[model samples]
Target: MTRKTLLILLVSMHMIFGPHSFAQQRTQKPPLHAKHWMAITGKPLAATAGAMIFQKGGNAVDAACAMIAATCTMWDTLGWGGETQALIYNPHTRKVVGINALGVAPTGATPEFFRSKGMKYPPEYGPLAAVTPGTPGGILVMLAEFGKLSLKDVLEPAIQMADGYPIEAETANLIEREKERLKQWPYSRQVMLPHLGEKREAPEPGEIFRQPDLAATLRKLVEAEQEALKQGKSRKEAIYAAYDRFYKGDIAREIVRSVQEQGGLFTLEDLARWRVYIEEPVKTDYKGIEVYKLTTWVQGPVMLQTLNILENFDLRAMGYNSARYIHTLYQAMNLAFADRDFYYGDPYFPPAEPVRGLLSKEYARERAKLINMERNDPNIKPGDPYPFQGERNPYLKLLEKWGEQQKGAAKSDSQESARSNEEFEKDFYAGTTSVIAADEEGWVVSVTPSGGWIPAVIAGRTGIGLSQRMQSFVLDEAENPFNVVAPGKRPRATLTPSLALRDGEPYLAFAVQGGDSQDQNLLQFFLNIVEFGMTVQEATEAANFNSFQMRSSFGNHESRPGRILLNEAIPSWVRAELRKMGYEMTFAARTSGPINAILFDRKHGTMWGGSSNHGEDYGIAW
Candidate 1:
C-alpha cells in the first residue's frame, strides 16, 4: 500500500479497535485525510449526515444544508427556529459569496415602544425577543442557488432524526439544566421536556429522544413542495412553495399571533417582506492567502481586521504561545474588537461607517502603532477609519450611550437599576453550532447556524420554537445606527463564519461555537496552521486565550477592561509573563470549542479535517 493509503488504513483500524471510552474525548484525535471529501460538525451525527449526503451524489452546498438541518435537530444550541450565516466558495465560478439570513426587527419595534414598557433593553425571553424566522428561508435559498438535491431529499434525514434519535449525554445534561426555564412556557415545556414515564426530567444518554412536533412541522414544508409539484410547478418553483408556507402562510400567521398576544410587535407584513440575501464576501490577503468574512453586519470582519494588523508582525518569530506572541495577539485583537464594537453594523443602513477603510492594510498599520509592548492598555477606543480613507466621519461621536439620552422610563430606584444591570450581564453568553463540508468538486462551505439558547418560548403549535435574536439589538438608538432596532434591519450579530482562499482557490473552510470568543479563537487557529506549521488536529487542540478587556457582543455590552483569560494548559511561564505585562490573568481548563475545520492543500490534491475534542465535535475524511 502507498504511504498515505497505509496511514488511512491504520487510522481506521485504530478507530475500530481502540477503547470506546475515549469516544467522547477530543484530545485523542489524530489528523485525518482523504483524497475526495470530508465533513466536520459539533455533533457526530451531524457529520455522519453530511457524509451520507456526499456519498449520495450531493455537492458541498447540498451536504452543508443536510448537515445544518441535522445539527439543528440534534443540538439545542442551534435549532431549526433560528438564524444562519454562511461563507461559500464556488470553484466553478471562482467566486466567494456571503449568505446572510439574519432576520429583521419588527416594523413596530421602536425605542419608544420599549420605553413605554418601562425597560431600557429588550427582554431576554418571550415574544418581545423574537424576529422573523430565517433558517427555513435560508435553507431554501441554498437549495435553489447551489444545492443538487430536492428539499425532500436533503431534509429527509433531519426529519426522520427529529422523529426519533438517541440523545447524547451532553445534550441530555443541557436539557436538565434548562428544564425549569423551559417549563416557564407550556408550549416550550411540552415540546422539549416531554414525559418519559412518570418523571419529567431529561432523558438518559442512549434513550430515544423524539420531537414529533418538529418532525411534523418539517413534513409540512415538504408537503407544500409536493403540492406545488402536483400543480405542475418547476422544482425551483416548488421550493418557493415550501418557503411561502413558512414565511407567508400558516407558519407566519402562527408566529405572529403568538408574538402579538404576548405584547410583541410582529405582523404578517413583517414576515412576508423578509428575504435572505446572497452578497459578495469581504476579503483581505494574509501571507498570500486570501481570508474572507461577512461584512460589518456580523463580527466576521473582526478576524479579517485582526489578521491585517498581525500580518505586519513575524508571528512565527515571536514564538508560538510565548508571552510576547500571546501579548501581541491580544493587543491586535483588542484594537480590532474595539473598532468592531464602535463601527460594525448593517452596511445596508445609513450613517455609513468605514467598513472598507477598517480592512485596509494602512489602517491596520495605523491601529497597530497604538499597541504598547510594556503594559496592557484598557482605554483604547475606536479609531478614525474615515480619516485614514480621507472621508468624513459618519457620526458626531463614535460611542454613544444606547438609552442614556432617551427619557429614563419612569425613574426606577437605584436598587432596581442595579438589579436590571446584573440581569443584563447574566444573559449575554448564548450558544451556537457550526458545520464545515467539502466535496470532490472543489466546492467548500463553512456555516455557523445559531440562536436557540432562549428557546424558552414556543410559537404556539407549529412544533417550531422561536429565538431571542432581538436581544442582539441595542435599545440605544445613538450607539451604532446599523445595530439599532429598526424595521428591515438585521441586528448586529456575533455569529461569524470564515473561509480562506490560497492563490484564488479554496484553502480552508472553518468556524467555531464560542459566543464572543469566536473570532479570537479563529485568529489563533489560523495562525497555528500558517505560522506554527501544526497539523489540523494540533492546531485545533492547542491551548488558547481570550481577552475580555473589550465589550462583549452579548447582553449589556459590558467590558472587563484589562482582564485576560487563558487556558490552564498554557505554560505557567507565559501566564506569569502576561501578568508581568500588567494583565489581570484568569485561567480556565480549556477555551477552544467545538471548532470544526477542513483545510485543502490544492497543490497536493488532498484534504485534512479537524474537529475540537471539546464537547461532541466530530469529523470524518473519506
Candidate 2:
C-alpha cells in the first residue's frame, strides 16, 4: 500500500472498529514468517525466549517486545520495573525511529524549591524522587506500532519467571551485595525477602524467590491489552493501560500511599500525567560509515561523536593493547565526556541557549582537533564548541586524581608496590545485562536492561530504589532544572539502547551495559564491526580498555573526579607507551561492559545474533 493509503487505512480502520475494537487484531495470529531473528543477552534464558519466538516464525519487532519481557524476568541486573529508552533503524521507510521510555519529572517539583527547602539532592533512592517509570510505556508503544504478538505471548516467559523459577547464583549475589538497602524497604523485603522474613535471606543461590505480585501485574496487562484491542481503545489508550496500572488508578494509589507513609513526595498527578518523548535519532559519519545515535537526552549521541574523532586516525597501525591505542582511546573518551558535561543536558533545559549546534558536523570536526596525536596532557580542560566565547565554564571535576611525580618523577606501582589512591577508587562496571533482536523483515531492537542502581538503593513498601542519576546534575546548582530537586524528580540516566543501519537497511541490533561504560563499550563494538571489520565473536572477544573516569556514576558522589580506571586487560606494552605520553592511568579488575548485538547480512540474506564473549550468552536457532 502507498504511504498515504496505509496511513488513511490505519486511521479509518481504527475509527470504524473503535480504537480498541479489532476483529482482525484479536483473532489474527502474529505473522511468523521471517527467515531469521535471534535474541542475544547475558542470560541464556532471555536469549532462548527471543530465539524461541523467532524459531516459531515471529518477525524482528515481535521478537523485540517478547525478548524485553523475557530479559526482565531472567536477567538479575535489569531494572525490569525501571524506565527504558530505544533507537530503531527502519529499512522500508528509509528513516531512523526512536522511543524515549525515560520517565518525566513531577509537575510541582523544581530545583530552586529544593534549594529553598534544604538539601542539594533528592532523598537517596526514594520513590518521591522517581520519574514516572517508563519501561511499560516503551513496551506498549512498540507493540501498538510494530508488534504482531498478543500481549500474553510476548509476556509468557516473564510470567513464568515471576510466578515460579529456580533462583540462580547471580540473582542471589545481587541481593546479598545490596542486602542492607533491601532490608530498609518493606516491598523489597516482601518481594525479595525470604519466606516472610523468617528465612532472613533471599532463597539460596540455586533456589527460587517467587514473585506472585509481579506475576499478577503481568497477567493484568495481558488481559487488559486484549480487551482494549477489542473495545476499540485508542492506540494511545491501549498503550496507556500498561502505564496506568503502574502509575495511575489502583496501582498509582497504592504506590502513592506506600511512599507517603514513608514521607515521600510522589503523587497521583505525576503518575497520571507522564508521557514518553518521541524524537529523531542522531546520526553522523565515522570512517565513511553512517553512524546513527540517540539524542543527548542519552549518552548514545556523544558516543557517536567519540567514534567520529577516533575514526580519523588508524589505531590498527598503533598496535592493539599498545600504550598508543590506550592513550588515544583515553583521550578520545575524555574529550567526548568534556563535550557531554558542557553541551549535553535535558534539551528541555539547554545549557547555553539550546545547542542544536552541539551535534552539528562543524561541531564534531572542530572538537576532533583537540586531540594531541603525539603526547598526552595530564592537565585536561573542557572543549568550547562556541568560537566567540571560547569559554570553558564546564570544568572536569576530579573524581579520582592520579599523583603527579613530585618532581616529574612518574611512578608505576610495581608487583610489590603499595596500593595508591587510584587503586582505592577502582570499581568494576558490573551488574547489568542487554538484549538484541532483528529479522529478515527489517525490524531491529537493542535494550540494555538495568534497575540495579536504583532498585538496590532502597527497600520498602514502594519496593524499589532510586537511581543516583541525580548526582550528575547536582554539581551546577545554577543550571539545574526546576524538577531536579532536594525532594523529588528522576535523574537523567545512563542506560540507553542503540540501533544502526547501512544504506538505509537494517544492519545492526546492539547494546552495552555498565554505568558510564554503556556508551564507551558501544563505541568500540561499532568500530569492531564497521572499522576493523571483525565478526561478532571476534569483536566481542577482542581485548580492550575503557576509561572509567571519562563518564560514570561511580566513585565520589558529591565532587566530580578526573581519573581513568584502565582494565588490567590492557597489555603492559600499552601501559609503557601511555606513561611515556604523560597520561595517568590505573588497572581495574575486569572492568568490562556487557555487549550484546545482532547483525543482518543483507548480501547473504541471513541474520546473526549473539552476546559478547566478554559475557556468557549465545545466539540459538531452530
Candidate 3:
C-alpha cells in the first residue's frame, strides 16, 4: 500500500476502535496481578521479607508485620524506636481495625517546659524531641492477635538485616547530608558515620552497614519469646512476653538510660505505661463505599472529611485534573484540613475532639456550601462542628481569634514572609513509608510507619533511634487545644493508612509517604481509580495537585495558603486558570506519589498491586 493509503487506513481504524481500544493503557510501571497473595512496601528488601513470610503460609497480618520489621531495620524512613499506625481488615471479624501504636510524650514534656526552653513548638530533632518508643509493642500486638507465625519467624529478616545490609544510595546520601546533626549524638555518629573525619563520613552507596547493637536487641526479644514458649506459654502469651522484654525488661532500662544521658525526658514509667490500642476504626461512606481511617489522633480523618464534602458534588463530571476539578478538590481539602488543624487530636485527651460532629454528613454539607466555585478561598477557617452533634462550640472565642490570625497570615504571605521553596518542600513532604499486604484468605493490612528518620539520634547501646514525633505537637492551647504538649499524650501525627470496603468486602488498601500530604495524595489516587477508571498502576503514576494550605505538622507548623503544587504535564492554560483562581502555583516533574497500594479485584478473584515509579517502593505477588 502507498504511504498515503496506509495513513488513511490507520485514521479509519482509529475512528472505528476508539482511543483505548488500540492497545492496553501504557503506564510507567506495570501493575502486578496475583491469585493468592500480594505484598508491597517502601523498599524492595522489605517487600521481599513479606514475600518470604507469605511463602511460609503466613497470613496478610503476618506478612505485614514482617515487612514493618524489615523496613524499621533498614531505616526506610523509620527505625525500631518509631511509631506505627495501621488499618487491618480481619477476615474472621469482617471489620477494619485500627492499631494505635503511636508514642506518647514523656514526663516533663509539657507546654510550659518547651516554652521555657524558648521554643515555639517542640524541637525538630535531637534527644529533646524524642517520644517513647511504640513500634516494638505495635508489631507484637498485631502479630499476637492476628498472625499465624511465631515472632521469630516474622522477625528473622529484620534481625538478619540488623546484623548488616547493603545500604541503598538514597539512605546513604541522606545520612551524609545530615552528618552534622548525627555527630551530636555519640551512638548515632558511631553507627551512621563510620569514616569519622573523612570528607564523606556516611556509608558508601551499597556498602554493608552493620548494627551489632540492634541485632542483639532484636535477638533479646526472640529469646524472651522462646523462653516463654519453653515454659508452656501460649503463642499470644509468648509474644506479650517479648513485648514486656522490650518495654519493661532490660531493653527498657537501656533505652531510658540512653535517652536521659542525651538530655531527653524519657523515664522508666513512660516506657512501662505506653500501650498499643487496637480500637475500632472510623469510617465514612461515599457512593456506597465505606472508607476507613484511624481516629482523630492521626490525620486519617482529613481524607474522610474531604470525601464527605466531595460527595455533595459530581466530581467525575468536572473531568479529571481539569482546572475545575483541581479547584474544587483543593477547596474541599482546605476546608477539611482547617477543621483538622483545629479539632482533630488525641481522642484520649480532654477537651475531646468533636470528631462525631466533624465527620458528620450534615457538617460536611455545610462546609461544602462555603466553597467558592469560582476561586480559591485562602481565608477558609475551621467550621463549628459541635452544633452538628448537639453541642455548643466551647472554643468559639478561640475560633474567632484563629480566623483573624488566618486573615492576617493571608495578607502577610508575601515573598518576604514565605519560607524558601527548598525548606518549605522539605517539611511539606517529610518522613514515612507505607506497607500494603493482602491474601486470598480475605485479609488485608495497610500501614504508615514513620519517625526516627535520617539524622536520628541513636539511643546508646540499644541502637534504637529516638522518635521525633514531639515536633508534631503544638506548645500552646491556642494553636491546637487537643494537641498541646503534655505527658502521656500522643501528638496529632501525619501518618495515615487507608482502606475501603464495598458491599461488605475489601476493595482497596493504600498508603503513602509525605507528611501532611499523605491524605491529599491518597484522595487523588482513589479518585483516579474510582472516578476516572484508571488501572492501579495508572492511578499511582497519574499526575495530582497538592494544596499547601494546611498547617504543616512538622517544623514551625506554618501554613502557606494559596500555594499549590502541580505536575509539569499540566497545560499552560490550566496553570493560567488556577493562577486566576488566586493560586500561587509551583510545578514538579512528578507530583502524585511514591504510593503503594493493593486493589482487591473481587470480581476476578485476583489482586492488583501498584507501586509508584518515583521511589523504591516495590511489590511481590503469587
lDDT of 2 by residue, 444-497 (tens): 777665553424433233333333344434433322222233323345456667
Clashes of each: 3, 28, 0
TM-score of each: 0.90, 0.81, 0.96
| Stretches of model 2 off by over 4 angstroms after superposition | 1-35, 55-57, 107-109, 112-120, 195-200, 230-240, 349-355, 386-431, 452-472, 478-490, 554-569, 588-592
lDDT of 3 at 375: 88
- Writing each residue's lDDT as its tens digit, candidate 3 over 1-622 gives 9998897666544322222334686878889999999999999999999999999999999999999999999999998899999999998989899999999999999889988988878999999888999889999999999999999999999999989999999999999999999999999999999889999999999999999999999999999999999999999999999999999999999999999999999999999999999999899998888999999999999999999999999987777777888999999999999998889888887879998999999999999999999989878988999999999999988888997765554455443346787798898899999999999999899999998988898989999998999999987666677888889999999999999999999999999999998899999999888877777888898888899999889887778889999988676667888999999999999887889998888788999999998799999999
Winner by TM-score: 3
**TM-score head-to-head 1 vs 2, winner:** 1
Query: Which candidate order results from sorting by lDDT in descending order?
Result: 3, 1, 2
Off by over 4 Å in 3: 1-23, 407-418
Worst 10 residues of 3 by lDDT: 13-22
Kindly report the root-mean-square deviation of model 1 from the true structure over all alpha carbons: 7.0
